[model samples]
Target: MGTGNTNWKKDFDKAVALHKKAINGDKQAAQKAYETLKNIKFQVNNHSLVEAYFGSSSALIARDSTDLTDKTNYAKRGMKALDQAIKLDGNNVEIRMLRGNVAYRLPEVYFKRTKTAIEDFQYLIKAFEGNNRDISKEQYYEILLKLGASYKTVGNSQRAEETWNKLLSLNNSKYKTLVEKAKSTGGE
Candidate 1:
C-alpha cells in the first residue's frame, strides 16, 4: 500500500511532532497524529518504527478518550502494536521507551503490564551503557526515576531503592530541585 509515492519520511517526522504535541495535551494533535501514524504504518515496508509511532498514537487516543470502552480498546490495540514493534526490533530504544511508559501507566490488576514495564526499563538501562542515541540523557533520567517507582509499585522495595540511588548518583543539575526533594523524601 505504498501508493502515490508517499514521502513516508516526511510523514513520519510530521506525525512524530504531532505525537509530541499530543503527549503534551493537545486532543486535536492526538487525533491527527493517530490518523497519520496509522496511515503511515500501512504504507511503510518495514514496521519497526512505524508501528512504534502508531502504538504511541494509540496510547494517546486511549488517554484522551472519554468512554471507558474506547479507552480500553485503544489501549489494547496499542499494546498489540508495541508487542509487534518490539518483536520486529527489540533493541530499538524509542520503541522500548514508548512501550515502557504505556505499560507503567496501565492498571496492573486489569492489564498485567507491570512486568512488561519493568523489562522494558531494564532493557533501556542496559542500552544506555553503550553508544545509544535513540534517547537522551533527560529521558534516561526520567526512566530511572520511573523505574524506581515501578519497582515500588510491584513491592520490590530493595530494587526501588537501588534504582533511586542510581538516579541520585547521576546528580543531573537540571533535576536538582527534584533530586533534592527525592533525597529528602526517598522519591516516594
Candidate 2:
C-alpha cells in the first residue's frame, strides 16, 4: 500500500475565511478571494472541492455587476457550482447548509428553492439524531433553528411550532429569548 499525503486544511480554511467575508457583506474581498481560489486547479479531496465551489458561489453572488443580465448570469453560475459541490458531497452537512442558506434567500420568481433548503435542514436534523459524531452541539442547534424557520417560511406553522418546541427542550439558556420569540410568533 502506498501512503500519499492529502491534507486540504490550509485551502479549506482559506476558502472558509473568504466565504465568511462574503457573508459579512464584503463583496470585493469575496470576489477577489473566489477568483484566486478558483484558479487553483487541484483539490485534495471532495471536501476541498465543496469549499471551493461554495466560495466561488458566494463570490458570484457578491460580485457587483450593474447589468441585470450580468447579475443573473453570476447567480446561475453560482447555483451550478453549488449543485456540483452537492453532487460531490451529498452528505456533508456544511455543504448542505451553504446551499440551503443561498437557496432560502433567493426570490421565488428566480429560484424558488426554499423546499430544497427545508430538505437540507431536515437531513441535518436526521443526521444529528442518528448520533453522527461529525456534528457539534452548536451545529445541531443551528440546524434545528433553521429547520423551524424553514418550516415557517413554507407556511407549515404546525411543523414549525413542533420544531421550535424541540429546540426549546435543548435547554440552552442563551437561545431562550430567541426561541421564545420565534415560538410566540408561531415560528414566523
Work out the TM-score per prediction: 0.87, 0.74
Q: Please estimate how well model 1 matches the true structure, expressed as its whole-model Cα lDDT.
A: 0.84
Candidate 1 ranges beyond 4 A from true positions: 1-6, 173-188
Q: Which candidate leads the pack in lDDT?
A: 1
Give the TM-score comparing model 1 with the true structure, all chains together: 0.87
Number of clashes in model 1?
Answer: 0
Which residue pairs overlap in candidate 2's backbone? Answer: none
Write model 1 residue lDDT over 11-123, tens digit each, in one string: 88999999999999999999999999888877775578888888888988999999999999999999999999999999888899999998988877789888899999999
Give me the displacement of residue 109 in model 2, in angstroms: 4.9
Q: List the residue pairs that clash in candidate 1.
A: none
Residue-wise lDDT of candidate 2 within 1-188, one digit each (tens)?
11133454466567667767777777775675566456443443344355435545553564566777767777666666667777777788777767776666665457666687788788877888999877788888877877787788778888887887888898998667877777677554
**Candidate 2 worst ten-residue window by lDDT:** 1-10
